[model samples]
Target: MSETDTLRDNRDRGGPAQPLVLAQNLTKHFPIRSGLLNRQTATVHAVDGVSFAVHKGETLGIVGESGCGKSTTARLLIGLIELDDGTIVFDGDALGSAISLRDMRKSVQMVFQDSYASLNPRLTIEETIAFGPKVQGLADPLGRARDLLGKVGLDPNRFAHRYPHELSGGQRQRVNIARALAMSPRLVILDEAVSALDKSVEAQVLNLLCDLKDEFGLTYVFISHDLNVVRFISDRVLVMYLGEVVEVGPVEAIYGKQAHPYTASLFSAMPSMDPDNRTMEPPLSGDPPNPVNPPSGCRFHTRCRFAEDVCSGAKPALATFGNHPDHLAACHMHDPASGHSLAGAEASA
Candidate 1:
């Protein structure tokens, strides 16, 4: 069977019919050098020991603070950046070990932030969308581009002829999304895709993404700092802090009943419509420690309210707790034997 047919089959069966994307112990570290000889200094652990799987037709939202390594993880997954250690498996093929990632580019595409900058100013909309297909030698490239433009809610007869400068912020974003689809990729990484758009426009674009997913059977690795947006678009949410996944599970569980203190802190920061719920505590103070010298153990121990001696000295393993079997978190608070219980502590407070 052709590659496209195989991909469709996999999607129909809920994955590579199998696992389309698997990231195992993925890590990225940039070494700091000093002096003329440029000896190896400290390393920035941008993405350390993060693992997850994205089945076909699923949107996996990766949420974290600005320096928490969300974008770095996205780049590592798509092979845009070199990983210091880990395995990236795409459609059963290991990308990290492969000689070149260029061959996988068509199958995996990215929609970057800053739509204005991502699109070539000199190229017209049609030229921009057709770039991928032409590069891949796809037959009927223009036809595909036009179809994609319409799919993204842009009229080929109109906007496709215009330059990026002529379109609104929303329009530019649509073109960016269309360009990712132009390659007919099985996996699409949206790195802060709508973070730059206005609220109303962001909703519209998100709706458009949902529609496109159903229509094209796409799997997405959506990276964003906007927790509400992530909750809306993702089937599962992965919460990261200081280069590690602190929690991951279904969206409802992570947002509604956050098990980890860090996840709960993130949810409390979400803008709520209920005025009564507006009394949530202020955001956690103190900036995340430098990645080059991250806190030992849980990494969040320094800021965590429930942190204890064990927290600073020994790292906690990810564990499933309470009612949600799918819900997983890495924190000392959830440890049964730790003699630390949020329920008891909250009551005393």
Candidate 2:
């Protein structure tokens, strides 16, 4: 069986299929305020009605350009920031009184991009990893911390007493990963956790993550600007554009088809290794529109090559693109009733 099949199998493991984390119509807008009293001026649409699920034991990779609300989405998932709208259901329970934010956090943890800033300068590595379990009143926090350190390939005796400043970038990241796992979280939201390390170090860390996932039976929502890395680690790929999910499907399906125009452009922009296959023109033109005043209909209409009048008039719903129910795209081209020249039964069918 292929790697994709393996991922799908693991995702479909055990009894009835259910997402470990299910988010619906998630929205968050940062209100801009100015002047003496800090009066409201404009609202930056950080994440507008974004929704997706992290299946049990599957890594759902989120990919997009900078400032596309990737980190914000991660934060929203772990409840680091309160959602302006929408509901989060984790492992079958609602995120309010049913599960409780505090309880949810115990099962879900996040690893940020900045390795140095993420760890406390004051705390020793062992102290840092043990902190969460200590707070939870778990049995033998230090023992757990040492075991975690060993699992992450760090020598407990040598590195456990060291501070964040004492270790290298890769070592620091491993420590961060260990710290995140200290709570014995079932789902981990990794927001560019490997972006800071060098290529060699990155590969090592990525392998470590995969090995750890298998050992722990953990679910991951991996957010990264690195398309290659996303492709490497994801079971399903979620493509984001200016705070909205343009497309989401199985990793192989997405990398093969790229049904959404935005997703196509993103893949096109990836730098090729071969000199013969060089990119002549830009895959996507211009920067994303101001979130405060996005386009009337499709936010990507300004840069989309196949955009039609309908794209600027009607907001496309996130619907199944073709025969595959799991593969969905938010594009007028996929909707037969959208009235775009390329949208119809014949076009999509």
Candidate 3:
């Protein structure tokens, strides 16, 4: 079937016009055993009641330090792993519902971090790109694959037969993107997609992604540890720490009027483009607390400079900011009930 046919079929089958990719109180826990009996000793809460939504055609950037469960959340949303609690609703359907994920696979795709590791060593670029379309039973799979390669700036005739090892790092990444796009997915989860490339190459790949987004009418869930890249491509940004969303707002609000201490610290850590007007703070100190037994109340309290007694006691719920309904953050700084500020709350670490 063609991309249009597939999309129309989905639309006709009672799907929402503006579909939402949402995680409603999603949670994941991994058991840690102590003995040969493999008895559950402890549980690592990788994602604890995390919730968010990715609207159609918008890029929602998930950013955090390593082990903050950003990737784990991605895994849960796409049904790569089973969730311990809550639901991942895509287009008003729960993940793993009677409708096999296999059907939705064509609409939702992922471009992994390491292109070299993601592609099969035995498969040629043509074979790799053709795999998805063929599995989805697309007509003229190879022709479509060749067209996707062209979209990614690769000459199909010259590069289609090459193995992943035969291609340069950037070339392999383009192939990976093409392979994912072969089925014309509505949403593409980019898990650190450009993290492994050289700076110059990264810029090229990023620009290519922007071009493709406009060309294909694609929505993206961009996951990355690099704040700079996230700021550049994201329409909205979510800041996570120890499996919870500490803050979420527009990209400009995140970088300019940061509410959560954790979010502010993150922007402050980024090296300023202008050296003379540097107010960027020093890098955060200490390791993130263990997820298995995360800190009480606020997960970021361990490292948050503004952490207080209340932060260690009352867990904050997402609250809207000054007159901006789109801006919501789970922090003690903004009172959801009153929409008022908390004084001296930002200076407490």
Candidate with maximal TM-score: 2
Looking at model 1, residue 319 earns an lDDT score of 84
Scored against the true structure, residue 137 in model 3 reaches a CA lDDT of 81
Report clashes for each candidate as comma-separated counts. Answer: 1, 0, 4
TM-score of each: 0.91, 0.94, 0.91
lDDT (Cα, tens digit) per residue for candidate 1, span 1-349: 1455666665343334567788899989888999899998788889889998887678999998888999999988877788898888776777745524886776788999899999999999999999989988988788888888998999999987899999999999999999998887878999999999999999999999999888777889999998878978999999999899999999988877887888888877777889876855676887778889889988988888778887888788888855788788887777766555453343233
Candidate 3 residue 277 Cα shift, in angstroms, is 5.4
Instruction: Compose the digit string of candidate 2's lDDT tens values, residues 266-341.
Output: 9888898889988899997777777787777888898899888889998888888656679999999877778888
Q: Which stretches of candidate 1 lie over 4 Å from their true place?
A: 1-7, 10-17, 96-100, 275-277, 337-349
Q: Considering lDDT, which of the candidate structures 1 and 3 is the better prediction for this target? A: 1
Q: Indicate the residue-level lDDT of 201 in model 2.
A: 99
Name the Cα RMSD for model 2. 4.4
lDDT values for all models: 0.84, 0.88, 0.84
lDDT against true structure, model 3: 0.84
